[model samples]
Target: MNAKKKDPIKSLGIYCHVPFCVKKCAYCDFCSFSGQNSQTIADYFKALQQEIRSFALARFNSDVGDLAFPVVDTIYFGGGTPSSVSPEYIQKTMAVINEVFTVSEAAEKTIEINPGTLSASKAESYKAAGFNRVSVGLQVWQDELLKMLGRVHQQSDFIQCMEILRSVGFNNISVDVMYGLPGQKLEDLTATLAELMAFSPTHLSCYSLILEAGTPMTNLVKAGRLVLPSEDLEREMHWTIDRFLKAHGYSHYEISSYCRPGYESRHNLKYWEMVPYLGFGLGASGFYNGVRSVNTSDLKEYGRLIAAGKSPAKYEPPMSEGELMSEWMFLGLRKLNGIDDADFKKQFNRSFFAIYQEAIDSLLKAELLVQDGSVLRLTPKGQDFENQVSLAFF
Candidate 1:
């Protein structure tokens, strides 16, 4: 594993899933567990470390053929609440990464935390371990809404979390906010944004709640115990957020994300841009060399496979040219600035319009898409109906 590589290296992104949480939110279906014993937690981290080492040592074969070791430029630590774990685990895992891969000196290292799970000590440990960015999940500012959403933390917890992270010298902070809650109102959403703006986070991800099947929240809605905002009201809320954030100096860079200048989520951008990334930990997904792989979601199964010195991930075949082109259009359109036809041609070696001229013409006639110089972007109307526009490419 210590041997150097002969093949040329490619810049990559690394996503490490921390699948432990203090509690699972009612709406969360992500592969994470709460109430696991200390030993189980310990075992999981050991297996995770082993998985990382094995990937680094392997020839990294895929349908696209043999590839060189990746030089990681962005490392992201996400869900169930990375802050819920002991910082020692994170530090050790990072040590394994640095030992195996060629991490860029200026890599953007980020970790996601929930309110009430962070402390001065944990923040300090993360800082010392080379994490330069933190994303705090606040959900909503109202205590009642937080409770309704099954979040364990209160509004005060978020306030305290911000204070501690700032005091520990973490300036690249991103906050998560949710709208379209069961009982959320326009005023409530506005209040949450106004209060959060006072903290001046570098990035914000405002999302509309989607009721996933089998989740407690979805069952409640199905049984009519809870009610969501109407379509008209939800539409208003979206525009309100767009106007409010734009007025306050944040650029709407992506469909669901806004940020200050030069502060985009570098790791997340990799996903939209089709850049290669490797995912580790239970149920994590990775894409590289035109192949996609997802690790087993069952923790025990993942452990057994790793313990047996076997790969735990299931790999999909290389994506076809049509699949790649379709994905490039839809994913690229998620950005506010939209996709460039020239860049598309450069990658696929075919004219963008030559393939999708009919779809583009239809959307253009409907006033949902506009061709600005050489770029194809969504109109204001198209932004409101983004899903429909993105699906047109498919």
Candidate 2:
């Protein structure tokens, strides 16, 4: 056995990628595009079932079977849009997973639903099929900014979708909200927050817009056709969301996600804590058995690989002990509580000060961090410039 692959306290989560959506959003750089009139989704699910079956076979083939992750405690259906496919598709997918792996009865099962693709019947069907949580894309509440962000659903559509889920008795619902879009104003954010808070979702995720290089949004900005909020305004927008959500009794568990007490997302927490998880689709990533891998992003190439009875894993990097310790510190800082200094020493058999002596000393002098006992956390300014502080740990 590879000593580094030894199991730890963290449990595994399963992520099933639904790579189809009704319409592609303008600024989305994810592996998503239009899926109307395309049977690609259903075909991919069939291939995914095959992959799950292979996982079961691989488990049974292992020399030490019981030590393997025989049960998945959380299953996250991420996307494109899980709702675009029929409830029957999801049911079948769950069936295959049940047959292949042991699933915890209390497992947190979630599906991402796009507002334009959801209906009351489908929402109820998901609940019946054991989906305890639902996330809907309501990126912006204003119709004008919605159009600017190239979202397909109207503000009314989002309202209707939320109403449908609420009517179906879904209490654990989360909505996605975005900031820093072209022509967005402070009033725009306040209005959107007000409208969404009216629905009283259990969770909310506020994201800042990122204009990736190859996206059309970048092109418009380069041509001087689109305008974004100034740096000062952007900072204010972030601070406003942080303040409002906290006052409303939501926990900012991570940078972008906020939830009412006891309503935090279980599946996503696995990633932030650097726990082992499995990924099963094109462009998805997994960290398991001390090896991390990503599937190919190209739809055509991914489909081909799966059809040929392959798992389509790419860039499978095995992490070293020192590397994992560093990652534990780096990724854990993304949370509000920051990393455990004692945990770092136990894992590395060396003090945290041994590696990050200069960086920690510098940040402390700059007043960018606050240490309460052994917990080292970023100050407000440091959280705003997280990429810079996080680099110090490395």
> lDDT for every model?
0.90, 0.81
RMSD each, Å: 1.9, 3.5
- Judging by lDDT against the true structure, name the best candidate: 1
**Candidate 2 per-residue lDDT over residues 112-190, each given as its tens digit:** 9989888988998988888989999998888888887787789999989988888888889999989988899998998
Q: Which ten residues in a row have the lowest lDDT in candidate 2?
A: 1-10
Off by over 4 Å in 2: 1-10, 64-66
Candidate 1 lDDT for residue 365: 93
TM-score of each: 0.97, 0.94
- Residue 63 in candidate 1, Cα distance off native in Å: 16
Candidate 1 residue lDDT tens string, 267-332: 999999899999999999999888889999999999999999999899999999999999999998
In model 1, the clashing pairs are none
Clashes of 2: 0
